[model samples]
Target: MARVDVRLGRRVRDRRAVPLAISLALGLTVAALPVWATAHPAAARIAATTHPSATEPVGEPGGGVPTADPTDTGPVPTEAPTTTAPPPEATPPAGTTEPAPTTTAPQEPAPTTAAPTTGAPVPSPSVPPVRPSAPAPSPPAPPAGVHVTTDDVTLTAAYWNAPSTVATLRVTVTNTGATPARIRLAYTLPAGLTDAGTGGCAGAGGGEHRCGEWTSAPGARFSTLLRVRVSGDAWRRMPLSGSVRVTATAPGAPGPATDDEGFAVLFPPGPPVPGITLDAEEVSFDIGGGSSGLAVRLGNSGRVDAEGRIEVVLPAGVTVPAPPPGCAPAGTDRTRCSLGTVAAGRTAELRLPVSATPEAQLRAPLSGAVLGQLDPRGGRARQLRMSFRITAAAALATPMVSPPAPTGSQGVLAAGTPSVGDGRGGSARRTAILLIAVSTLLVVFALALATISLRRRLAVPSAGPPASPKP
Candidate 1:
């Protein structure tokens, strides 16, 4: 019986040895897993697939174990195998002897793939914010409150005399604004009227005139008299019209203020009387050497025949050097020509050759008048005055005075008399000859004086031989 018990104990020892070998194999594989996973990343993926729940928790304080983030897009991480306690052995019943234990290899679990995570939201690309903008500017405004006014004028039969009559115009400028402003006045004269050179207005050409600036206070008014002449032909148009404009002179001011006026020309109720009108052409001549034709036109607007004498008066240094066949010198600066018995509705004209001297005043007006009678016995005389301008000629040269012609000579110059319209060659020759003759005379006088001085020295005997050597 003692020997049988020993054999049974040996069998029990053999059964325990199998379980110990299995535990040792599992521990060795777990230790080598980290080294194998580092060498082969593909093996790590397979190992992760094999044990999904074996992964450790991460991001927890004081827990060094790493875990897979559910939101991570990278490959799943692998985990090492963990050790566990062995299950307890089962005991047999007392009646039957125990059979020998069978030894078998552990079966590996099938590799499981991790399902796709679908919890955390994916973030969109970052974007920027928006903003706004700004605005524009405006324009300027104008001024207000100024007034201009003028009075009407009338001309009478007395205006149809030798010279034209001047009619006065009254213009008033008033300011209704609260502020004082400087303003200027401008006026335009219509046809058949001209500025009479009497008013304080300056001519701006083209029948326009302008006055000086005046400061006008609120509710204050000022008046100016403008004199305008009624032209000789103004009788044709009985009524005339004109306009006045007032404008502010300040910066950024408004447009102009305007007013209009009219003139009425009246004549007496009677038969049509004899009326004479005169007109002449404007002339431009040189001071020393130019001539222009002076045409005097006499128009007799009468019912019956009329007889008249036309007289021309020129300025100083101007003359009608060669009068026409029917013209004669009336005075030093006047010429008279008869217009013998001009029929009704007939016009007469006389042309005279007018000349100017070197001493003539430049830009002076040549004035004249005409006197007419309806009856040769006795009647009222009618006169008309006319004028024309004389301007300096272009390209002036040296002035030369020509000798006057002999009396009673008709358009005939004296022998060897140089005329004002002669060529430059003759003038140059005359100048050269005069200079040569004057130089020759000066040389002859100098030689005669020298000879006389020498003869006087010899006749004086040298102060009697120096008074015998001063005794």
Candidate 2:
């Protein structure tokens, strides 16, 4: 009985060993299933080759050893495991085949073990702190000056004799300085040329036109137009050829003075032999009795009668007397003495009386010109200009003394009084006249008395005194 009992115990122990080994193997396979399911294709391939019987050890709960399915299908068997493991989860549906998962190789971490063999360590690129830089220096400024220029001139001619021709000029002035500058502009015309007007410039005329004291801002420009007239007979003979100069001057400028010049040439129609001559026999006059006399003659050398005016020019403070025959006051210091129908080859005489005002300067010189035109179509006669000297006596400094009446006894006194002719004042004039008359009469009486006395002494005493002296 003891031997039979030992054989049966050995067979039972062998049966129990098979179940325990399968339980441990199933626990390990369940634990490794998720890793194999989630691994790369290479890893899957390795797991497939290394553990082909991985799931075969698991069995059903009723206690039969589970068989491996050729195609992966069905659920995992529920069995009590000998070791701890996660639950088996299904990866695919009942009918579909699950594709193998793919993954890239794990990149090795940046080598922390060794230094680089070829080059030094490439430091992580870092940006430097932003800092401001200084600014560059500025350039210097230019010098200061005034700039000037002119435009081309336009000239026109007319057949009229009064003003025969006209000329126009335009000027431009510029300020190139940083600050405001003052400028003066001047225009000079040739002889026989006169300024008619300026478009925008205010100026004075004295053979030239001058506009002054104009202020201009920096980079500012000014433009002006000037017009002139030519009326003299000389223009008929000679073509008008001259330059109109525009000058810009600044007293203390940083640059040179500027000159802008333009030239002009013009011609006008000529007239017939209209000979108009102007002459003055006496050119100079001494101021006497607050007045002076000018003897002027106008001769017509042409064959036709001349019907123009005798234009006379005089200085300021001198004027023609009232009621001057055939003479009319044209302007200040100017007179138009009309020559009514002067016959051919005849001469006309005129005595122009010019009186000086209190403002007249002593020893100053003034000029007078006599101009005449015989006919509109004829040429102008020779125009003569004469200079006059302003000479005045001491009485001119005082109030002008009235001359004696022409028809009164004072006329006789004035006619015989030499002192009155000499421009003597009232007080000294009367005394000098009286003293001269009395001394003259006394000397004549004394001479007569002495002659009579000498005659008597010589004749009568010759008879008696001669005989007595002989005895």
TM-score of predicted model 1? 0.28
lDDT of 1 by residue, 1-471 (tens): 112234345445544544454444445445444433332233233434433321222124453212222222333213111111112214423333322211111122221111112233333458443233422211111232356555555555466563667887766555544444455556777677788863335666676776544444433444556678877675444323456666543222332333223222232211134465556655557545576667767777766667867777665666888888878998897788887887767778878887876445332222222332333334566665544444444222323544332322322223443323334434544454454455455555555555554564455432222223333
Q: TM per model?
A: 0.28, 0.26
| Candidate 1 residue runs with Cα over 4 Å from true position | 1-273, 286-288, 361-379, 394-471
Model 2 backbone overlap count? 3
Q: Number of the top candidate by TM-score?
A: 1
Score residue 422 of candidate 2 by CA lDDT: 30
Could you give candidate 2's per-residue lDDT for residues 1-471 as a string of tens digits? 112234346445645554555455455545444433332133223434433231232233445211222221433212100111112223423333222211111132211111111223344469654456644322211223455444333332343455446655555555544444444455556566677654323334445455423444444454545576665554432322233333222322333334344333333222323455555543333444444477667677777776656766655565677727888888886788876777888887777886766444332223334555555346444442322233334212333544422321321232322222233333444443454455455555555655554554455422222222333
Instruction: At residue 38, give the lDDT of candidate 1.
Output: 33
* Model 1 worst lDDT run, 10 consecutive residues: 77-86
